[model samples]
Target: MSIHRLIVKSAALLTAGIAIGALLAGAAAAQQKLSFLAAEYSAKTLPFWEQVVADFEAANPDIDVTLEVVGWNTIHDLTAQRIAAGTMPDLVNTATIWVPEWVDAAAIRPLGDDLVDATLRADFVPALFDKGAVYNGENWGLPIAAAARAILLNKGLLAQAGFDPDAPIATWDDYRSIIVGVKEKTGAFGYAFDAKGVRAFRDFGYYLLNNGGTFFAADGRAAFNSPEGVEALQFLVDLVKAGAVPDPLGTTLEDYQPMYEAGRVATMINGNFAIAGIKANAPGLEIAVAAVPVKTAGQTPVTWGVTDTLVIGKAAPVEASRKFIAHIFSTAVRNQFDEAEGMLPVLLSQAGNPAFTGDPNIKAFIDMLPTSQFDPFHPQYAQMQELVKTAMQSAITGAASPKDALDKAAADFNALVK
Candidate 1:
């Protein structure tokens, strides 16, 4: 070959190599990074998120996602610490109650119609999405996990107490009779009452709502100390007085699982997830689920519907984070998540899935969705919940009468609202 031709070919090769390197560098620079802080719902929570991230990354090579799963107990503190340090994650899974606080702090961005299209928004269970994810006329988060509360009865214990396990408890009076009977006959605690922890207010809430009580009146004043509220608390206090529950002042909902599994308690009010735990820990135990008893036979039955949501940080790359959110909210991914966590489906599309419909436990909870109620969304709900817990504890431990305890709580809650 001629020397000139050889020189030209070599120069052309060098130019091509430089162009290729520049393109590779540009691709790396264009890649978007998203960090997700997820609450650990169970042991499977981390593994499930890991698979999701892997799958998302494979499909969108230009967007990289980092996932960190923490227990429900610690996720709030961890998120707060991150926020204080100015290192907030791009996405966070949090309880719906906390959304108001996060919104007030301007920590998260409202998910407008542009981010969550009409089709995707329509797919969510309307009751859950409207009640939980929407705050102040705007959608602020995506409902990721949900559970409906129910009464879980031990068939063996009820039978031993001479009550048919299949009998429906249509009124509070009937429920009281059965629990009292179980306590007197079987010597097992009739009810597993939880009165400790941040969520202890839920125990009282069960009775409060059933008896036509609301935490706050329409005018935003504290109304939990009304006649109905006092009656509800008194009923629970009487149960404690009658020794129908064990250590009402000391036990949290989590504490009741083992006792229930061991057949030490006749009945307990808990979410559908508890059914999964009981079955896994005590496979031989016969469990019966029923609607929470109401104040009267003709009154409607109400159950607590709780949901945890996904929110995007204000500083996040909104477009990329939204893509990740959309991917996880897909019916296929959501069905797996709900099944693994023993939670009801938050998406309407999953309501008909055979995996959920075929499972009687899930069906029981699902059946209660029509009458489900959620916690009031207030900026100071956490503080209000603490006040409610303290009031219940005070009443249960004889520090004060149910009326006085609730009155004090109501006064304190009103002060906060003002």
Candidate 2:
């Protein structure tokens, strides 16, 4: 009853403890963990994703999800660092234009029937899903958010400029007259011209596309130096020279957004998401939403439709990641995310949801979807965009004429494509 019994009991307890520890470790190893790198859409973005992660974890106890939200400006660099470090996230949200590069690098996996079933693929808005998420004839991603550009007019400034606050600007001539009138009468910038950074190409695109110009021709050659492109660039340059916009050489959309919200800018071209920002920042400011006026009457209105995509990394735990992707792409989740971020829904099922249909600002963007054109999703398109930005800055600063600047850009773009 003394030494022998004590030693046996001690050994038995030690064996039990080890067995329990091994079982616990195995259980922990059985749970799948996934990492998500989301590009920040707004202040609400992180919080919304946090809630989604919480809900997903609660519903799927066997899967663990971690969310990291980075600003749009830094996501690309951060993602590249993660890839180089061999620690890529299971899922990532990136600008749709960047998909081609990621595909070219083989950094992401294609979402085939195994990941995205036919039913799920069919639910996405065709224009967005087909054009934005497809690369090299494969579905590479899903559109996380979509937006279409439109013009926002300050009604008070329009009235001050002796134009009907509710009148539609039907042609470029009418729009130009209002731009000059607003500056002359109110001494406020008539149009907010963003001529710096990546967005400069977007600004130029509005004019170029509306004027029947395109980034590439039918043969996939650079066509931005065509007469239509030159005319559009000249229009913007002329506006800059006439004092219709402020500091076109130095300003960007981020700089002008606040000025517009403060009612110091008369008009600006912005995505439908701007309505939410304007409402939040300047609740009392009266605003009017209008189509970007055509180059001439009857030319048909065009808008830029942009989408940010959600992709799965090649190194991801495919089963767990696919389950999560399907969960988020469901109609209810998609609607909530789009509403919170003030983005147009990428899901066709959510297009007619009351939350979107009830808002005129959202309706306007939806209406423009028919005539919307997206950026070229080429591997070198980012470089081409930078070249275009350089030309825009040169033209705006009077360092070169619009035609000359664009001609040089076109040459560089052709070389890049070749």
Question: Could you estimate the TM-score for every candidate?
Answer: 0.92, 0.93
TM accuracy, model 1: 0.92
lDDT for predicted candidate 2 compared with the true structure:
0.86
Best by TM-score: 2
- Angstrom error of the Cα, residue 266, model 1: value is 1.2
Candidate lDDT (C-alpha), each: 0.87, 0.86
Estimate, for each residue in 44-103, the C-alpha lDDT of model 1 and write its tens digit.
999999999999999999898988999988988788788778888989999988888888
Per-residue error at 324 for model 2, in Å? 0.8
RMSD of each: 4.4, 2.5
What is the Cα root-mean-square deviation between model 1 and the actual structure? 4.4
Candidate 2 lDDT tens digits, 172-231: 889899999999999988898778866888888888888888888866667888998989
- 286: Cα error in model 2, Å: 1.6
